[model samples]
Target: MNATNAPDTVFETQRPRLFALAYRLLGSRSEAEDVVQDAWLRWHQTDRAAVRDPEAWLVTATTRLGIDRLRAVRSERIAYPGPWLPEPLTVDESPGPEHRSELAEQVSIAFLAVLERLGPEERAAFLLKEAFDYDYDQIAELLDRTEANCRQMVHRARERLQSGRPRFEVEPARHRELLERFMHAAQRGDRGAITGLLDANARLVSDGGGKARAVIRPLLGGERIARLYWAVARRNGYSDWRMGTLNGEPAVLGYTDGVLTSATVAVSDGEHILELLTLRNPDKLPIPH
Candidate 1:
């Protein structure tokens, strides 16, 4: 390696992990990308030689920046016109630590939505320890908190997130099968078929980001969601349904006249779909014009 280029090389090595941390913390793909870029800038400006541990330095900088970004966006999220779902991210064949381990579940829409309940500092602490596998001491150092405090944060976060997160993991094949069934049922406007596939307490959350048409609030109950799907099929109609993976789980994208309309993914138990998260905001969809 070129001696002068060592710093850049080192930062590049840690970039993927840094990005994974930011994305989980912020939820929005664009916002997470922005935070990572900002972290790079700070790394470039700092005195590299003086930093004894580059990884530790970078992690601290990234966590602080992510916490600040979360605090900054709190009000904007509250005033959001409708429900604010995480921007859909298409996990591809990218070489990164995020693709390995159980990281996918940590980044899922359902999990991230549950994380929204945490305070910025608390969220950072929990994610550092839980998602990234940082030791309690490392997390405490990264967040400038006591070890006991970091433990408390993770414990509190887990408790708060428990009710919203799935208790059991569904097999990948089963998850894909359920998504396929939902797509076919929705397209056919078969209310009974859709209802039968849903759990007793299923809910549907739609996010349009106030840029397009979407529900003002989440629809609760299996029957109500099934009815809404039926109504949507009857009135607007759907074409070119594409099934794929988003955030490491099965998702289906609906398009009309070759223009993307909505992207939906489900949170399922082994037996039933607990919730459906649909992103209709064109700006947030992962597509190129």
Candidate 2:
């Protein structure tokens, strides 16, 4: 398409990619959408004649805006009332084999949680490089750094992330099955029944953004968390629990009275659930009226 090709069309073409990048960088859906909107406004105001590749131009703009937003959010997270978790991306996405192959391993709650440890620059560099398939030269150009500097940032980010996660694989099917059983027990207020599905050192993290009922601290030990789930069910009755794909992984999507209320994702070792992440914050959810 020529420079005069409908600008809105061009922008819409890139919106999904841009939104995904921003969401990964900042871990907030609303913040990411704001960044994408800002990028759109800039695109609208910029000189189209001067822009050769609109995709590249828009990507650079969106990524930079995301970086800035991430910095601000990181500071805000410091004063957050409790442990923060990424806003769950609930999509009824049925990826083709290729999409699944590309993202199945990396896009998970555990992976996103590790990203929170990275500095803003390091995280941006790493995400742009790995997820978007940007080259070092392009990353350097976007960040206004030397190629060597971008490479170093990527290296540091990779090192930090890899230092913790083992080089082993876990089956997504196993994790999905475990969550089904776990949620089933919880829905029945049968807390002890699901104990066998958990790792002995399993952990439960609840993020309610201080606007909902969430544990102020992460619940450690399988028994304690199971009891918590049971108690919630007993008190509130069974939520409309369903399974949905979130960040390329199978997770339990819980709704109350036909509105999305909660989400839970599990990190398993192909055996038992090692970590369960529950996001109950209405702010982070897409609640239907």
Candidate 3:
């Protein structure tokens, strides 16, 4: 078949799946869209007749483009204002018949945040194995590593994830309820209520990026965090803080003088909040005009 005759049909059929893969890898939808567009360009440049597995070819093209862009953008990420959270996913339009339930827990904000802790190669290895369900051989080929090494990387990444012990199985509705209650307590300066909602070992990590005044160190323990919240509420209570959905999960966004100042997303385990992530680095906020 001539390249012009049928590749368009093939591209259209495969584009959505490629997008889902790219988004999960890149953590930024806009960047994923760009990478996919670049992949199409490469696809068009190649001799369609020479290609054996179009899907595999597309995946390789997309992954390489994403990795390249990630390397190029690392400097900008480091300089990002306040706490740099992944771009909030406004909608979950993952392509195809895979239900949200079928998607792995790694797609959650908390999970992605943990993925950010790994080195680039480790992150790539883990995503290819866990999220895409690719075998070690395929992951090695995609990442240009030996199969044994790739397996080791995946094992190490999995160990880190396990150590975090995140509860990705929590229902969104129940999680939202807990977050709302916590936000209300914080807003009202109810130290007792807030303390009750936090785990004894809960920690609050604020990303103020030196622009906004935030607790630099991770605030540990339920009692300490509760007291911190009380002090903050007493001082900044006048600010308009609201509980809302962020990245399809429960979050808190605060505004001062009609300008967005900071936001927080908490990871909970049934009974209490385990990790409280505050993004106050002004550079990190995707301010809407």
Candidate 4:
């Protein structure tokens, strides 16, 4: 590559990691892309030769940008219609080998929902330390806080996320199997069969953004969730459905005349689903190829 293009090559390599960090922080692919594009602009204008660690510089820039974006969008999310959900992303969208352990579960829609409880700084600190496996000192630098402060932020974030987290991890195969079973049962309008695959405390949350048809409030309890899906079936809603992966988990995508309609992601504990997130908002259904 020519000298003029060296910076572009370098920035492109770090793009995936940067986008992943941004997505985790903002929970919106479009917002993450905006942050990444901004990062690229800054990187291009920086003194590349003087920069010792390009990755570190880009990561820090991306994290700070993500934190800022999260803070800015907080109020908008609060005023959003119904329950707001993290924008669903395709599994192949930005999967990078550099992500820390349990990347899939960390990026799952359910986990992102739990993260909504954390403040912007706490979310950044916790994700940098836990999800991305950065050192406390590094997290502190990234968030412009002291190491001790960063630790406390991570601690608080962890405590808040713990209560809403799934009790146990489920293998991908088992997760997919359970989702398939649930889909079949829901299609058949077999309320009993559907409830049997859900935990007693199972909850269903959908985001229609007030522009589509969806439950205005969260539906709690296995029986209630099963009944809702059964009703949808009776209305011929699940007539055309396909299994796919979204937010690193098994998901069912509903379509009409080959147009994507709804995408439902299931969070299971090996045997039963603990939470179900369905995105019926047409504005949020774009799957990255």
Q: Report the number of the highest-TM-score candidate.
A: 1
Q: Residue by residue across 1-289, what tens digits does model 1's lDDT show?
A: 9978998898999999999889989998898889989999999899888999999898889889999999999999999989998875673323232332354566777778888999999999888887789999988888888999999999999899887788886777777688788899998899999999999789999999889889889999999999988998998675567676667666777777877777787888867888999888888888622
Among these predictions, the greatest lDDT belongs to: 4
Candidate 3 residue pairs in clash (backbone atoms < 3 Å): 81-281, 81-283, 81-284, 82-281
Candidate 4 Cα lDDT to native: 0.85
Q: What is the lDDT of residue 171 in candidate 4?
A: 65
Badly placed stretches (over 4 Å) of model 1 are 91-103
Candidate 2: misplaced stretches above 4 Å? 1-5, 91-106, 164-166, 233-240, 287-289
Taken over the whole model, the C-alpha lDDT of each candidate is 0.83, 0.81, 0.75, 0.85
Please give each candidate's TM-score: 0.92, 0.87, 0.79, 0.90
Q: What is the lDDT of residue 123 in candidate 3?
A: 76
Pairs in steric clash, model 2: none
lDDT of 3 at 178: 77
- Global fold similarity of model 2 (TM-score): 0.87
How many clashes does the backbone of model 1 have? 0
Residue lDDT tens for model 3, 1-289:
6646688778878998788777777677688889899999998999978999998899888887877877776677677653455654542222112323333344555666676666677877888887789999998898888999999999999898777767456766666677778888998989999999999999887877777888866778999999998998898675577765455455677878877777777888866888888877665566532
Worst 10 residues of 4 by lDDT: 92-101
Please provide the root mean square deviation of candidate 1 (C-alpha atoms, Å). Answer: 3.2
Weakest 10 consecutive residues of candidate 3 by summed lDDT: 91-100
- Give candidate 3 regions above 4 Å deviation: 1-9, 75-82, 91-104, 167-174, 208-217, 238-243, 253-263, 280-289
Task: Give a tens-digit lDDT track for model 2, residues 153-237.
Answer: 9999999999746466866566677778887888888877877788888998888989988998988998888788788888988
